[model samples]
Target chain A: MARVVFTANLHRHIDCPLQTAPGRSVRAVLEHVFAAQPRLRSYILDDQDRVRKHVAIYVNGERITDRERLSDWIDDDDELFVFQALSGG
Target chain B: MSDRLLVGTKKGLFELRRNHADWSIAASHFLGDPISMLLADPRDGTLYAAEALGHFGVKLQRSRDDGKSWQEIPAPAFPKSDTDGLSVSYLFCLETAGADRPGWLWCGTIPGALFLSKDHGESWTLNQALWDLPERKDWMGGGFDDAGVASICVDPRNSTQVTIGVSTGGVWRSGDDGASWHAASEGMHAEYYPPPRNHAPEVQDIHRLVQCPAAPDSLWVQHHNGVFRSTDGARSWQEVTTIRPAKFGFAAAVHPHDPDTAWFVPGVKDECRLPVDARLAVARTRDGARSFEVLTKGLPQQHAYDLVYRHALSVDATGTRLAMGSTTGHLWITEDGGDAWSLEAGHMPPISCVRFG
Candidate 1:
């Protein structure tokens, strides 16, 4: 099981409590999370399933590079943080 | 129907309710969020709000109980594609299809895209026919990087027939429910562009488009070049250069049941986008733009530098109530059409759009 946490700013709009889901890869883990909270997909990704320009995701405190594939492997105790990148004036 | 006004602003959404001759703020939601578009469905009385967040992107919220509570829903997004570099900047317009299509909703957005939802805005799909047009390659945004669909007018007589106005992209009409599209800006001119390009069919900059419900065939447009009206279903337009002060404006409100009556707030040319002579007034034409009467009752007439956006002026279904908001954070209402106006609210965030619910 991987632990997933959302930014406080996103919590202001939707109730995205800490989620724990079982998966081998980041993509599979996020797929399970998004299935429960579908509205978060539009804010995090664009039409092509690519990570949105201002959205950032990190696996074990390191930024994920494969935004399109999102195939990075994850361990049972690893943590994922999804946050909106600081943007605009 | 109870009188209410939904005001979208750069900061949040403000709801105003009428009490006798004056209007007061009823509720305010989405504080500190940039509200771009708002609409109230006549069929179910559902209120939809579009917000653009700098970090999170575009979002849609819906309320069924007159905005007392809201729920965020999945918004329209471009399909992931390698070559597509488009992202929704903001939603420009929200409209219901008609009485026949109960749960249908139309959304026009920045980057010049049209989306339709059959399940009341829970999900949306892009109109690929309009997006795939060859002319779209040249559609540039007037204010931003890409053109935006500023207005959408669906024919009440035929829900399949739709007219869309795009900034810097001209007008497009679809007679088969957006299956196909064609340029309908024949006589509309774009004086800002050089010769030949100025008269091109798809180069006109349309600020707003409004159609009279009583006569669906009659359409009024506030073009960046001037003000125009088309009697043959937007197939052609004739500039109404006779409008007093100047025809350069962003907003136009049409009477609900009168085809010949409409109102506009005229500002100076693009160089100076303020009211003529620094006097804020609503210019109305009852005889189809033949002449104009400036209504200034209870409005600022001296040193006022307010500009109304394309969706900031609205007329209710009965054509008796009117509400308008300004970029300077001033709101005004008229219970008896455009005959008289009174300040409803002031000193708030800059208003983006206004709708009477």
Candidate 2:
């Protein structure tokens, strides 16, 4: 089983809550997280279920770019961190 | 009753409706000037619009009974001497003072002007107090244009406590119904000022202001650089959110009931037109300003360059419905508290501004 954590630097605040779930692949892991917190899903994915261009996610410190490839194999001890990638002038 | 959507295009005002199963454009004979704002008042089902004509300047128009007919309001003229022979920009916001204070319409303008309409959309009077503020001199030295006044909120219960966003001028509060005002930009992010340090410029260029009706002093301001919350009227404010996106977009709508619930759209850089490759979406903050969530469901993925200016976002009186119009000519409506959204219009013209009816 893989574990996932969610954090954001929202509204000038930081280090809030870290969402955790148990699953074998990224898709299964995200589905579990969405089932528990639906509101966060919209911020994480686009209308086509792809990771928003502004959002970034890392699986066990390794950045994951494909939204559909969430079903990739993962270790039970692996962790995930998702956040908005800040960019601008 | 038919649901009508009045949209402004590069060509004039376009009235539209989703008939049966088809979304058809009703009329497009307004002459093609870009529309700056569109408002549908719910109290009486009236529609108002602001259009920006090249060289001719900004103009205001209205339609009583939903978008079936239209007429222009005489543009408030400034003495040729004071205006430098230039006309003021079109109205950006039209807010009624509610049923108890009928016929009280307040409009915010570009370049930071505030006008009051006591007779629906008829005659207009500029709030000299806001127009001639001592800080006006320091607030006008920002980016491109002075931005403008984009947000205005009137306390439904105590019309005395009114708040307005002066583009890059931060936020200003008036406890006596626009009679006099005070700067509420303390601690806000004002980037256009002298130096782009911490939060100085923010107190100057506020893009949106949403005052909590229950707690009149508690307000939320969306600035060009960050978001702020003031719990003690205008005395102080706390930094809530900051966006360093590929670009910048204006507009902030607060939930009618939950002061903690609000929404804003952050586009690419302030100098750019596209939304980081045309992927525009709205961000949500549920716990007042503690955190934010981006809502992309039902929104376009590719070529999504909709720019939602201030006042383009609105929530029904119930606060249960959330709606925002985009510059890409689309309106996204959410009835289930923004957990999900439905596309109301796909292509209208880049929507300049939107108000709920």
Candidate 3:
């Protein structure tokens, strides 16, 4: 299971706490996270189900490369961090 | 009369209360957020405010006990398809479907799509019939980067008879709810285009479309170029060339009881979007569009550069109480029609919409 964490700024709009989920890719990890907190989906992705331009997801301190498909590979012991791009807010 | 006013602004949603002599700010909600549209539902006094956040996209909030508290509701979204993927950039308008259909709501959104919420904003469905029309392919952006639903006029006589105005696209009418629809008319002319192409309905840019509740057949529009009046239910529109000051404006409010009486905020055209002579005045006509009377009493007459948006001017059910908000962050109200408008608030933020309840 990979550890997932969201920025503290998003806590006011939707609750997102540190958690561990089993996934091998960024897309699967987000799907596991959104499956529990449904309302958080739109805030992270747009209508096309792609990552919002202003939001960034990092895998163990490395920025995810693919925003459209979010196919960046993840390891079981890796850490995922979601942050709202400063330029957007 | 509705003494409560809801103003959507660039920063937040401001609620104001009317006093014996003037209006004053009572409460503020969604501070530091851009409120795009508001609806004070007269059916059951339900208040709705739409916030367009730059970072997190659009959000909808509803308050039943005035402005005391709000509940987050799901905003309308476009369905995903491989052929064409569209998203709602912003909510342009929120309108009620007459008093009879108390729970029904009509929403106009950017990308020129319409959505219907039967459960009072709790859930919304995109109007697919409207998007499927062939005329939509010709739709273009007016002032926005893409085409948007500028105004929605639901027929008072029948809730199903809806007439929608798109910013760059022409007007569309639906008779049997959302089952079928058609281009309202080929009557309006587009000065931006050349020759016969200017007369095409798809090229028309309608700024705002408003209909008189008492006389549902009478419709008035503040077009991109000028003013137009339609007495035959938008089947045909006759250009009104007699408006004083200037015919270019973005907002128009019709009296609830009188079809002939209407109010419009006029300013200079095209290149210059400021008020004429840098003075703010509302043009009122009691006998249709034959003539207009500039109402400047209690309003700034010099060094004022306020421009009202499409949904910023609203007339309450009494027809005497009217509220107007401007792009320059000013709010005004009139209790005796449009004769004298008293300044309520200023220096707040740019206003997008106003609703009285």
Query: Each prediction's TM-score against the native?
Result: 0.93, 0.69, 0.96
Docking class of 1: medium
- Candidate 2's displacement at residue B202, Å, is 8.4
Note the Cα lDDT for every prediction shown: 0.89, 0.66, 0.88
When 1 and 3 are scored with DockQ, the better candidate is: 3
Rank candidates by DockQ, best first. Answer: 3, 1, 2
Q: Could you say which candidate leads in DockQ?
A: 3
Q: What clash count does candidate 1 reach?
A: 5
Instruction: List candidate 2 stretches off by more than 4 Å.
Output: A1-89, B1-4, B15-31, B80-86, B141-144, B195-203, B212-216, B242-248, B271-278
Cα RMSD to the true fold for all candidates: 2.2, 23.2, 1.7
lDDT comparing candidate 1 with the true structure: 0.89
Q: How many residue pairs clash in each candidate?
A: 5, 25, 0
Residue B148, candidate 2: how far off, in angstroms?
1.7
Where model 3 places Cα greater than 4 Å from the true spot, the runs are none
> What is the C-alpha lDDT profile of model 1 across B1-357, one tens digit per residue?
448889999999999988776689989999989999999898998999999887778899999998989988878777767785577877889999888999899999988999999998987999999999999888888877789999999999999999999997999999999999999998988989888788776788989999999898899999997999998999899999778777889999898789989999899988889999999989899998888998888789898999999999999989878888999999988877778888889887899999987
Fraction of reference contacts reproduced per prediction?
A: 0.61, 0.00, 0.53
Better structure of 1 and 2 per TM-score: 1
